[model samples]
Target: MNHGQTAPEDRARPLSVVLAGGGTAGHISPMIAIADAVRRSRPDARITMVGTPSGMETRLVPAAGYALETIDRVPMPRRLSADLAKLPGRFSRAVRQAAEIIRAAEADVVVGVGGYVCTPMYAAARRLRVPIVIHEANARPGLANRVGRALGGSVAVAFASTPLGGADHVGMPMRREISQLDRAGRRAEARAALGADPQERLIVVTGGSSGAASINRAVAEFASSGRAAEAGVRLIHITGRGKEVLDPAGSPLSAPGYAQRDYVDGMETAYAAADLLVARSGAGTVSELAATGTPAVLVPLPHGNGEQALNAHDLVSAGGAILVPDDEFTADFLAQTVAPLARDEDRLAEMSRAALTSGVRDADEQMAARVIAAAEAGRGEGRSRA
Candidate 1:
């Protein structure tokens, strides 16, 4: 296997690859990045994404120009209950649907980025003897990827501390726009684009696509407290769609140096204009910040098995970011921590340098290469079976 490059004998044969993962941007984004990488390496490759009808992948996958195949979502129940009782039957049905998709796509390989859909996809791929590659985007392994690892699939992880067995640290695959961002060069234009004062320092606050209510409320209260303006710091707050809208009337966030939007279609510009980030430490968000060399104050989500805190650990230890609990990330905390950080130019720059030290700019290419190798191996296995 020549890694990312298609094998000489296989060059004439168009590759068919099936990508599985969805339900959230964290899983879907990496899958899209790898899909783009695969398309760049093999323009003729037939890439099909498997997701549930209700997932964000339904829209995101089609928009990314890949064929999407839907499967029933079968969420695994953690405790003994009625849902647990229904698990086996739902899982079996989902696996059957996924197996049909794999066969129909003539998938040479199945790549899974952990989500509810991944469990069935992984099981189906294994049953069909298809090569499987799993990407775990969280620091702690999720249930689907954990099972994928146990099935002897090739595993890749965003963070080194991920507990998945046989995992290789491949870093998080970033979107093309973020990976190619030139923050220094685009700072002026980006600031202008977002209606920010050119000289004012900017802090970006976000909580993924759906937004974090706690982060939003904290920032809003901080804005109302008048500390951000006193420090001459601007804020760009992205409150996810359908969330409580920050009333611009009588709110400091509506003032000259502050801006609030429900969603930012162009995060690259927002990242370029930012001097600091105040957000949740989801795997994708953490990777993007590291890759962009942006300093941050990460408030991991309060729920969900403590994975978010683990995700932000290395960056915090490296001095690239500060980790605070969701409950502790209040207006006072922002006034004390974020205010000082924004005002201290030298400290912010140092943190930026530290962030870049741990970032992987070529993760998309690396993971794409791994997927290509797995596909080639699966083809060889199929031929041998024949």
Candidate 2:
């Protein structure tokens, strides 16, 4: 009955797409966006997600209304340890599990978005002679994606500066909400919905779904010091789930313009309401900020392969974002640097322009097209083999 459903003629042929990625929102969100795009273009397409059982993908993929097949996590060890000793067996088992899932799905093509589960999935897809497409979110390619590239998969990178071989700069595939958001047109409504004053400049601070301790502490300290209010900017701070709650009642700076929440379900509203942002430079966060033309002060997470720092480089260099080292993102820095930046309307407007110039609004569609082409090519190859 749905008008979007495939017509009778188109019902006979449907492509089976298997998307592999997980562990983090950076990987999973893009995967879902691409999948959504594929469904929009081909209503009869059968799409499934492959992820680790314990990762965030378990919830996110299913919540996005896609069937998810999960395998055990098999992280590649860097040094000789007990886990390294078990790597051979664990990896073999994971690959076998992945291969079985691929076979069951009868995947026309396998697409990887780069996460812990991708290594096994990539190996399995190769073994099955299935065409593989990879999307790397970070400027620095992860180990799984690097391995996938070595396996000769079609590669797409979010940043032009990503050093992956044979990579096409397709940009990060964003959620439909973000990709289609009309920030300028909807700003008033969005702010009103959030109970934020439409006339006041707003600064939104976030640290993904798991919250960053240092960011929270620094922002809280700045707010408590009354500098944020003095700067003539309202604040919307989203401390990640299960993190320490910042109490406004305890602070003299708890003005009507300041609001805090543990999580924001409608991120589009948050993006629309914000003139500036202060947050960790995760690949997803950076991409979204750029796409929305929301100027940012990015604090790269100190751990990992330093990929967060790399992720923020292009935007920072474009004058759309400012990258601050984790150690330097203190309360004093917020007071001295961020507070002044928020008050400068001319600079914020220029940064917003730069952010839009650095972003790609149609990346979801672009990635979907690539995935569909690979699927068609794979199906043609299958027929030829038969």
lDDT of 2 by residue, 63-109 (tens): 99998999989887778889988998999999999989888887878
Residue 46 error for model 1, in Å? 1.0
lDDT of 2 at 40: 94
Write model 1 residue lDDT over 144-235, tens digit each, in one string.
98988788789999987777777899899988789778889989998888777778888888887788989888888888667778767888
**Candidate 2 local lDDT, residue 180:** 75
Error of 2 at 202 (Å): 1.3
Model 2, runs deviating above 4 Å: 1-12, 247-257, 383-386
Report the poorest 10 consecutive residues by lDDT, candidate 1: 377-386
Task: Give candidates' CA RMSD values in order.
Answer: 3.3, 4.8
